[model samples]
Target chain A: MATKASRAAARMMIAPSVILLLAWMIVPLSLTIYFSFLRYNLITPTGNPFVGWENYYWFVTDPSFQAAMLNTLMLVGGVLLITVAGGIMFALLLDRPMFGQGIIRIMVIAPFFVMPTVSALVWKNMFMNPVNGMFGQIATSLGFQPIDFMGQIPLLSIILIVSWMWLPFATLILFTAMQSLDQEQLEAAEMDGAGSFSRFVFIVLPHLARAITVVILIQTIFHLSIFAEILVTTNGGPGTASTNLTYLIYVSSLLQFDVGLGSAGGVIAIILANIVAIFLMRMIGKNLDA
Target chain B: MARAVSNRTRALNTAVAGTLGFLMFFPILWIFILSFKTEEDAIRAPLEVLFGSGWTLDSFFTVQERSDYFKHFANSVIISLGSTFVGLLIAIPAAWAMAFVPARHTKNVLMWMLSTKMLPPVGVLVPIYLIFRDYGLLDTRIGLVIVLTLMNLPIIIWMLYTYFKEIPGEILEAARMDGASLREEILHVLTPMAIPGMASTVLLNIILAWNEAFWTLNLTAANAAPLTAFIASYSSPEGLFYAKLSAASIMAIAPILIMGWFSQRQLVRGLTFGAVK
Candidate 1:
């Protein structure tokens, strides 16, 4: 009876939020699904009659879709690689005895808190600008012609900026996890003649496996929809060189005012996100007992 | 011999680590220095002008004078705090339910909540915008707060629930057996025990809400504009003033940066709490 009463209470407590999300999710998704079949544009509202997947057909055939898809994949994959790799190094380094480690940690952690727009703006102007940016200055000093970072390699620049912003997160997680490891085991390994690399591989890396997965999964979710940096710096430009799926949706709905097509693009993004999420969730589920 | 070997390795590690840390932070540090430069000096080749010109607060003054710093700051404070509190209000009960009296679908429910977060806001953005427009809720602080709260609620609840779960259920059961009401079980017994978790959740949510740019930028115009929008406005192709732009960027981000510096440990803890657990 107590269990039943608690179960009912749980249902009651969660009901409002669940119902709200239900409407929030189903309404837009169903509308988007319905709109995907119609010739809908925000500018041209007369796309009322359903055209049987014509919108999807056009969206799939459009050259920008492939670019957007690849860009999204590259952005997500690229940042994850950089952040996770750099993060492990930083985390390990910070976990050991070092001078001014506190101050160094603070400096490293600062970028995570910088507003995305502000960070992007600073990078675009003070750091990445071809004429006066720090990068340009360094390149010139090194006897190499200044590279317009955004113009020449727009996606890579964005990826680097994001990696910087998120590396702290990965480091923090792995560091926290590393700190929690049993020190005796590490000393034991040392006493038994395990080299640094062997200890790191056998002990530290295993300890960080869950943290690494978390970093990858969480970052993937957020990075997939990265918009602020791209908007502030590149605006998906030099001709869609840096266009991601989210920006594509933005251009369609907000820029072109094509509601139907925009909604279609949105649905596609949702499906893609779900696919990534499903893979991540399955991995997490498998690792639950580990 | 062993001490010498360890010392040499340690020295090598420190040198490498220092360089990596410096590289990671150089852009932000350069931006801070550039914010104090004159427009002309700001655009000078970094090799020529860094630590070259006399530092001045003139850019800061101009940025403040040009933009209504207080108004934007106030809006940011209210929206971030309002949503975090509002989210806490709803999340407390929900988290309590899930943490203490979880149903069969508790993990599923939590996963579902988080999955909603993964859905690109653009997917439902048009409908929400239409709803907001039709209801005359566009560009209103209250509307922005609600949206921001909704946006961050799942993670807030997740974080709080994770915190709450660490509290033994037996404690709550004991309180109930003492003739305590449900509220007393939660308020008197449960919440107090979970203060650390709750505090971390609040701080983490505050940072998330403060840093949130997408919904704030899209839903807000002028009256409801926050710092994210303020920074976005600085990137006009015509201005070409890196100094003022960097100054504005600093102004827009300083409050949160200060807050984050203090709570960095707590935020990192909350973020990694569930992942490792």
Candidate 2:
């Protein structure tokens, strides 16, 4: 029953958002792409000569680029492994017939609400600091030397902090999915002499496969650009020990004043994120039809 | 039918889940406790910090007095609320149109909006920063409000679209049949029906905006700094002041935490773009 007038109204209603989003996406993005090919430095104020591939070459060839790329992959990979594994265990536990389920859930989900800066600094100073941190205190009391967490193993430390924040998200999603599981199937498997482990393996896992993928893909999108946690805690310190690609770009562009180099890095980041986005969009798109 | 579990099994599950939950929540719990202690007492070992300290609100007062905590808190309130408000205003019409009068390319449009979210912020950081610098929007609440509103517009539209889709078309049709104007139909029927969904969207967006650290930290320096940036400034020698840092962190996160608890279900739906449910 959509007449021409209604269709015109509908288009009018959608026009503003469409136009604004179009501008938001295209303007800055084209600027980034254009600047990537020019030797533009804010501090030097030199002539903007077209330097095709030079910025990309330097950004890639930089020693820190390799470290940042490796660190970025490790951070994302490590946090995913921990969150997914820990989330499954938590989801299974929470899904059981247990007392105080609501309270336990509230407690578990609290960390996800804590801002990144707060969580990072809390972990850095209160738990991981060598001198006055809780870990140090426990170690000294137990007759052991306190290990320097941020100093010795910075990336791993960040992974732990980030994992703590994200574990709740994974658990909540998995738990919601688990709750929708078909009880009859589990009972059928049980009646067929399947043990609890086998029931979880055969029946419940398949049910949870989609949810797990959702968690991994969604978390990867956020984790790949973990900027605040690293900024607040490590500052990518100890000589590029914990710098991710995002942080590397921030360093080059904002800190080091190399707009062209940073824009090139930004372009690389967009490409990397787009790769992940393609898979994620496919998954979400499949779900849309379902 | 739900199976009856043994009492022993139920108790075992309770114990296990409670212990694990507490373990997962210990850092927040620890900070909450430390926030009430004196600075020196807060730095003591865990056991002593827990038992040996006298409880006081001294650090809370000190944090306010020293850093003007209320200024940052106000910035967070204004920025988060402002962004969410602007986003909802822009998004409601777009979502409403897409939901009710969807054309062939509606799905593509929705997906395109989502793809914008996946574009790493770092990708556009340079141009946006320079734009802000040149336009004198740096470190201004208006600048942050504009940026965050745009940043969150896609999610807002997706969320509102999903919610609006759940609404039956017949209600709007019936309203139309009754000779209600389009504006009256939306303001009276569609809006009331969509309030719950919109509330959830607002809550989730506020939580996201409040905890947003990267842009808030990078774009603002002092005047318009939100609590996220405020807390980050403590990441120095002064951060060694455990009680004060805890107090500041608690104040910064407490509002969002309470709001977050209410929005967990909506959060899953929104963040996953209705993919899970």
lDDT per model vs. reference: 0.80, 0.93
True contacts kept of each: 0.55, 0.81
DockQ of 2: 0.81
**lDDT score for residue A20 of model 1:** 63
Top candidate on DockQ is 2
Off by over 4 Å in 2: none
Give per-residue CA lDDT, model 1, range A204-264, as digits (tens).
Answer: 8998887888788878888988989898889998898999989988888778877677878
Residue B94 accuracy (lDDT) in model 1: 84
Q: With candidate 1 superimposed using the best TM-score fit, by how many Å does residue A67's alpha carbon deviate from the native?
A: 1.3
Interface RMSD of 2: 1.2
Worst 10 residues of 2 chain A by lDDT: A281-290
Q: What TM-score would each prediction reach against the true structure?
A: 0.92, 0.99
User: Model 2 — TM-score against the truth?
Assistant: 0.99
Clashing residue pairs in candidate 1 are: A41-A259, A42-A257, A42-A258, A42-A259, A43-A257
- lDDT of candidate 2 over B92-164, digit per residue (tens): 9999998988888888988998889999999999999999999999999999999999999999999999999
Error of 1 at B102 (Å): 2.6
